[model samples]
Target: MHKRLSELAFGESGTVRYILASRHELNCLGVRVGKHLTMITRQPIKGPVVVAVDGMEVAMGLETAGCVSVEVD
Candidate 1:
């Protein structure tokens, strides 16, 4: 199903399909179309969402996470 990064549960995974943010920010994190990512942890109450991207851990804000679209099994 198509879902936002924020909607993914911890330990779940998805390929990044779209990011509604600046290209610089996107490239800095290596986020792009078809990039695989796993949800490591989602902070409670408007916190960041930690995701594992190619063995790298990155924290994304709730707002940014909401704009990231992903396809999941």
Candidate 2:
């Protein structure tokens, strides 16, 4: 099912299916189609979302996270 990355709960795993941001910028952070990620945590007050991508933890702002579509696994 397609859902925003920010909508994923902690410890939930998902595969990146789409990116709505600048591809180059998202790519720099290792976000791309077919990449699997796991939600680690989200800071309070609409803060950044921390996700595990390719064995590395990546911090993405709520806006950016909302732009990423994922398929929950």
Candidate 3:
């Protein structure tokens, strides 16, 4: 199913479908379409969301995560 990156549960993984914003910035962080991503951690109270992409962990804010679209695996 397609969902926002921020909606992914802890330990869940997915393939990135598309990004709604910050394309350049996110790409620099190794987040791009077709990349496999695993939700490593999600901080509470609207905190950052940490995801593993291509063996590297990247931390992004909740708002940014909300703009990332992914296909659950």
Candidate 4:
């Protein structure tokens, strides 16, 4: 099912469909909606995740997580 980034949890896997925001939001955080990102691992509470993007671990924040929309892969 399609869900927002904020809805994702640890051990959850999905794909980046597209971002739904203005250019301001993009500039504020150097992230594009269509960017391919996968959750590697997360913290106990709310924190950044070790997302596998282009074979790199990009630490993303809880807020930024909303930028990525993913589906079960």
State which candidate has the highest lDDT: 3
Q: What local lDDT does model 2 show for residue 11?
A: 98
C-alpha TM-scores of all predictions: 0.91, 0.94, 0.98, 0.61
lDDT of 4 by residue, 1-73 (tens): 8776667665566766776645355434444555655667765578765666667666666666666677756
lDDT ranking of the models:
3, 2, 1, 4
The whole-model C-alpha lDDT of candidate 3 against the native structure comes to 0.97
Give candidates' CA RMSD values in order.
1.0, 0.8, 0.5, 3.4
- Model 4 scores worst on lDDT over the 10 consecutive residues at 22-31
- Candidate 1 Cα misplacement greater than 4 A, ranges: none
Worst 10 residues of 1 by lDDT: 18-27
Task: Give the distance in Å from residue 11's predicted Cα in candidate 1 to where it truly belongs.
Answer: 0.6
Alpha-carbon runs more than 4 Å astray in model 2: none
Model 4 regions more than 4 Å off: 9-12, 21-35
Best of the two (1, 2) by lDDT:
2
| CA displacement after TM-score superposition, residue 22 of candidate 2 (Å) | 1.4
- Candidate 3 pairs with clashing backbones: none
Backbone clashes in model 4, listed as residue pairs: none
